[model samples]
Target chain A: MQLDSILFYLFAVQILFSALMTITRRNVVYSAVWLISTLVGVAGIYLLQGAEFLAGVQIILYIGGITVLFLFVIMLVPVSEESKQRRFSSQLWIVLIVAVLLTGELGYFLWQGADSFQMGEPTPPAEIGTVTTNSEQIGQVLFSEYLLPFELASILLLVAMIGAVVMAKARPGAE
Target chain B: MEEILDNPYLQPIIATLLIVAVFPLVAGYMVLAERKVLADLQVRLGPMRVGPYGFLQPLADAFKLMLKEDIIPAASDKWIFWGAPVLSTFTALTAFAVIPFSDKFYVADVNIGILFILAMSSLGILGLILGGWSSNSKYSLLGALRSAAQMVSYEVPLGFTTVTALMVAETLSMQGIVQSQLDKGVWIAFSNYGLMLVPAVVFIIAAVAETNRAPFDLPEAESEIVAGFHTEYSGFRWALFFLAEYASIFVICGIAVTVFFGGWLRPFANVGFLETPLNVAFPILLFVVIGAGCALGAVRVTLAYEKAIMGVLALAMFLVAGLFAIPMINELIIGFFWFLFKVLIFIYVFIWVRGTFPRFRYDQLMQVGWKYLIPISMGGLIVNGIVLLFTS
Candidate 1:
């Protein structure tokens, strides 16, 4: 096999194994750590391609931000005796069916997009011009074509934040 | 192995390895410098007894720390307790890979260099929280929680300020940012006459807090938290924490310099008359002054060891001065020197602020980060965006 294939397989294996471990681990903390490793592996896959920006965002947002939040909850909550008992419950058969269906869907998508998913070279977005950098191109798209959605998303987030604040606020007369 | 070694990529890898080797040594000296400067600010001699003017204090400290018994609490999570420091140090050092020491120098010039730095440094927060939590100490947990909250909060303003810098540069690559500054004939901080300065100021404040330095060091407030997250750590584990802290300080200050101040390029680089003389004389003059001080100290020192060390320091300083006197070496080194000099100045400000300011209360720190810094930074970003829009 070519070196590129070797590296891809390595990263893929890392992602898959860690992701598996994330769900299978007994301890919540261990599970979080495994999830972080899985995220890192995914970032590695992004880097192996030319998606440097995506790799960074993957690590920064998923591993650093979201995983840390998961860890915080894990650290704060007291461990219950039931938590370490088993990885699955009575719904395992149903969950297994769902998982198999999801996997099949993923496999179908991969097969459909196989030719497009060429390693190293991602298909460049339309309107390719002097702006070659991924980050700049992202900004251009986000501001120009996706401008309304971006603004609306920001507004939505603001509304959610304000709602959270209002809900979190103590009543004027009561504690 | 041979083929891999001979690859063009090996050069950057070798350079990275060299940097990794030198990093700890530089980080060690930073701690010593911090101690002595903090002492001087408070009118004390600091570490007087170590090799000439406490020059070797870091070595002594390192030795002491290494020789001390490594401790893990009986109830601690053994694996995590062992891994936390290594994780912290590794993540902090990983940021150096993309840091442009000069225009041509860096391990990897990734397109998303700034984002990579932000990501790596954020990972270091995981180290802190994990270390604190796994220690099985209440104080440790509290410290880690504080650190997580503080870092997460401050990161908002920090990210905004970085976005502002990126907007001004219109690029995310570290070298690209510097090149933009050079092309524009003004650092990002000084661009738009004065409008961009607010984000720079905001960046500095948020960086200090992000790095968990005083007045933003609520995570490790000694009086309240009792040595913070690494409270249960001892010996080499504690040293790793210290090393990571200083190295992050260096890296963050480096980012500040690269983004706000011009990286590598000398100030007023476009000016015709001042450029050559300023670049040539500045390094030489600095070394000469330091040599002279060392010479003075050498003459007055009583102990033979101290005298010898001082004499050697004086000689080394003179040697460096003479080295910089060469036009060829000076031409090559001037950029790197300017970048380092600016970084050092920022670091000095860090130490100066540490000495000057009392630690902020946790609530107050959060308030400053969220209430003051974020809104202002957002406003600054909008203003910058508008200016860039008009100018473009």
Candidate 2:
């Protein structure tokens, strides 16, 4: 087997396994750690697809930043040693029904496309996975073509920041 | 087999293996160097009982750490605690893959090299926090909390400085940054006619805090916390944390030099008058000075063993000097020499500041990072962007 396929299967299994463990763990700390494992496994999948910059960002921002923050919040919350004894979540039946319907819909699409699956590979865009580097291409497009949207996103973030400070600010009458 | 031996794809693996082998030795000496430098700064003798003015202290320290009993507290969560040091060491070592020591050297040159390091650093903090939380102790938890806050907050300025730097360089690969510096004939810190000085200051301070070094070392504030996150850790596990700390310092210093000081490039690299003398004489002078210091120590020491040890030290330094004197070897090693020379200066400054400065009050640290460094770094970034826009 080619190294690419081998790596893909390995990371694929790892992500699936870790994602399962993340939801199943009784201990919140263990759950947080398993979540990190799942995040890292996804990063490996990105790397396999040659999206190295995305892989790094996934590791940095997701596994590194968000997951660590999760752990921090988990630690701060005063919970007992073990979770409460209720085994299944209250919404399990509804969730299961929705999940089964989603799977049936996906299966219907795959069955419809089965004959076309063996067709020759679709060509990817030249700007991606080609002579042009994906990171540079992403940067050029984001700054030049999608520049307005990007700037608007930053504006949204700035507004959120100012609002947070305003809400947290000390009021003279409250004291 | 021959083809496998020469495979271009095998290069990074080989380089990584070499680094994994040599880095412990390098980190070991960094500890020794820190001790000796800190000792000198305080007007006291450092480790003298080890081999030859503590030259072999790193070896002795390693042996001792290995032999010492590994202790896990009863209250501690065993698995996460055990895995923490391993995670820390792993991330710290992985970051080395992107550090450009010379033009021809480095394990990997990914397009997102700096981001790769930032990712590693952020991930590396998990090890500390996990270690602390798993230890199930008050001091450890508090230490972990402080580290989480300090590192996360300081990461903002670090990100800004790095973005500003790569903006000026117009590339993300570490070597490309150096190449851009060579082409532009100016370091990023001195770019835009000194407008970059603010971000440079921001980077150094943020880097220091990020490493949990002195003045910003709230995580392991010895007097207050009694070894902080690793309070309950002992023996080899503690050694792993120690190794990770030194490795982190080395990597951070490497990034600083690469981004700001011009990695592997000598002073006045473009100057027509000084290339030969600067390249040839600099390394020779550096090694000879070290060799002469050992020789002097050898003469001064009264004890026979101490004298003999100093003599060996002098011989080793002189041998290295002699190797660099060779024309073929000189050309090959000059770039590595200049790179390490600059890195050593950085390491010295780290120790110097540790000796000089008091640990910051937690409130003071937050105030500096949020209130001062962030706004200044933002201004630096804006100016850098404007200059690039106009000049390009």
Candidate 3:
């Protein structure tokens, strides 16, 4: 196989394996570590697809920020007590049924091939003589075409931040 | 054979190997330099026994560390404890892949170079956090939490200051930033009608905090926490953490140099008249002066071995200075010399700060990051953006 395809398969296998480990691990911290591995594998796939900007964001936001927070929380909690409890609940049959149905649905979609999705051909990345880089293109499109949605998202985040602060703050009347 | 050598893939592999092999030695010497600087600042003679002027102190320290017994606490999480330092070292070294060392000597000039570095350094926090948590000690846990919190908090200002530079450069590539500076005839730190200096100052402060250096080094404050996160770690594992620390220091300082100060540009780079003098003659003159100092020391010292070692060092320095006089070799190495000169200045300043300042209280560190730095960096970005908009 070509090195590109080999790399893709490697990342694919790693993502799947780590995702499984993430969900299956008894220790929450171990699970978080596995989740980081899974996220990094996804980033590798993004890099393989030439989406360098997206890959960087994936690693930074997910592995760096979110996973570190998850680790922090994991360290804080009574993890030994939690780990002593059962890994699964009495609702296993229902979960198994849902899992099987989801797998079947995903398999069916994969078997149907690309024509069923009805997506257009994607534009190739810029070359030497082309206008700017992929990052620049992303920036331009984000600002110009998706300006409203971008601004709205920023406002939404700001609202969330305020809500979090207020929720965490002590009541004025109560010490 | 020619085709094999010409392969595009081979260069990066060679560069990677070269960095992996050379960086440890560089980091070791950086430690020696730091100790010597610290000693000088404190008015004490440092490490005179290992080699003349303690030149071989890093090598001796490395040997001693390697020979020491490895210890893993009985209560510690064995796997994580074993892996944490390795993880830290790996991430720090990997960040070097995107760092533009000079005009020609870089591993990979990725499009997202700065972000790649930021991501790698962020990942390095996990090493500290995991090492601390795995140690299963209160001091370790506290240190890790402080480090994680400090790094995360400072990263906001660091990011903002970087964004300000990126706005001026309009590129994320390390090499591209240097090229932008060259093209504009000004470093980003001095650009934007001098508004860029605000972010530059903030960046320096934030970078210092980000790397957990003194004055912001609440994470590993020896007085309170007993070496903090690596308290339980011993011998080579501890050395790995030290390696990661110094390597990250180099990487962070490198980013500042690349983004703010012109990466490999000589002083007065744009001035035509000063080019030959600053670019060529200055390094030679500087090294010759250093070699002369070494020779004088060698003559003054009474011990035979110390005199011999000093003489050898002086000879080596003179040889290096002589090499710079050759046109071909000078052309090849001048960029690297300028780049390393700036980085050494940065490293010296880091050690100087460590020597001069007392450790910050945890609350003060947090206040500086969140309250002072964050606002200043944001305002600097806005001001620079406005300046760029009107001036351009």
Candidate 4:
């Protein structure tokens, strides 16, 4: 096999294995660590796709920022007692139903193949050539075409942040 | 053989191997340099007994650490404790892949070079947090929390300052930033009517904090929590953490040198008359003076073995100076020397500040990072952006 396919299989296997580990682990911290590996595996996939910028953002924001926050919260809570408790929740039937539905949906898509999705064949990695322009092209598209949606997403984040601060703040003279 | 050598993948692989082989030794010597500088600042001799002028001290220290017993706390999380230092060291070394050491030497010149470095550094904090948590000690947990908070807070200003410089340089590529500086006939620090200096200064301050160095080293403050996160660590594991810390310090300072001071570019690069003297003659003269000093020390020392060691060092320096005189080799190494020279100055400044400044109280550290440095960096970025918008 070509190197590209070999790498694809490797990253796919890593993502699947790590995702499985993330859900199965009893310890929350261990789960978070596995989740980080899963995110990193996704990032590796992005890198193979020649989406360098997305891969970097995936690492920085998800693995670095968000997962650290998750770990911080996890560390503060007493987890020794929590881990010894039962694994499965009362909503097992609901979860299994959803899982089966999702699997069926994925299987259907696989059976239908590329034509049914109405998407074109992907641009080959060779055609993409130098990776430097990948980010520039992303910037051009983000700013020129998707500018409004992009700004709206940022504004939404800002509002959420302000709301969180307001909620977190001690009420006036509550002390 | 030619086909294998010509493989694009093989080049980066070789570069990665070279860095892995070389940087641990470099980090070792940086520790010696720090101790020597700190001693000089305090008016004392440091590590004189190791070899001649303590030149082999790092090697001796490395050997001692390696031979010491490796301990794992019985109550601790064994897996994480085992993995944490390795994780820390791995990320630090991986970040080096993007660092443009010289024009010819780098693992990969990926487009998102600066971003990749920043991301790696962010991931590096995980190693600290994990190490602290897994140690199962209050001091380790507290130290880890403080380190996490400090790095997270300071990263804001660091990111802003880098954004400001990236604006001026107009690219995120490490090599591209240097080329931009060359094209503009000025370093990024001096660009935009000196407005960029604010961010450069803030970048250095935030970097010192990010690397958990002195003044801002509240996380590892010996007096406070007894060595912080790695308090329970001993022997080679502790040494690994130490290596990672210095490697990250080098990486951060390297970014500062590349973005602000002009990586791999000689000072007065645009000035034609100064080029020959500064680039060629200056290094040769400096080496000659060092070689002469070593020779004098060799003669003055009473011990025969010490004198012989000093003579060997002197000969090495003289050989380097002689090599610099050759045109082809000069062309190859001049950029490397200047880059290293600037980085060494940066490292010295880090040590100097460590000696000069007192440790900030935890609250004071947080306040300085959030209230002072962040605003300054943001203002610098916005102001520089506007100026660039108008001018260009």
Enumerate residue pairs that collide in model 1.
none
**lDDT: which is higher, 2 or 4?**
4
The lDDT of each candidate is: 0.88, 0.87, 0.90, 0.92
Q: Which sections of candidate 3 miss by over 4 Å?
A: A87-101, A118-132
Candidate 1, residues B191-310, lDDT tens digits: the string is: 976899999999999999999999888889899989899999999999999889988999999999999999988999788798757887888999999999999999998899889989
Report the C-alpha lDDT of model 4 over B70-159, residue by residue, as the tens digit: 999999999999999999999999999989889887788878999999999988999999999999998998899889889989999999
The most accurate candidate by TM-score is 4
Q: In terms of docking quality, how is candidate 3 classified?
A: acceptable
Residue pairs clashing in model 2 are none
Per-residue lDDT for A1-175 in model 1, tens only? Answer: 2855798999899889998998877778878888888888888877666567889999888877888888888888764454756654699889899999999999987888866555555654323112237776777889999999999999998999899999999999996
| Weakest ten-residue segment in model 3 chain A by summed lDDT | A123-132
Model 1 TM-score (B-chain only): 0.97
lDDT of 2 at A26: 82
- Write the candidate numbers in order of decreasing TM-score: 4, 3, 2, 1
**lDDT for each residue of candidate 3 in B89-195, tens digit (9 for 90 to 100):** 99999999988878878888877899999999999999999999999999999899899899889999999999999999999888999999999999999988888
Clashing pairs in 3: none
Model 3 has an lDDT value of 0.90
Best by lDDT: 4
Whichever of 3 and 4 has more lDDT, that candidate is 4
Reference-based lDDT, residue A146, model 1: 100
lDDT of 3 at B210: 92
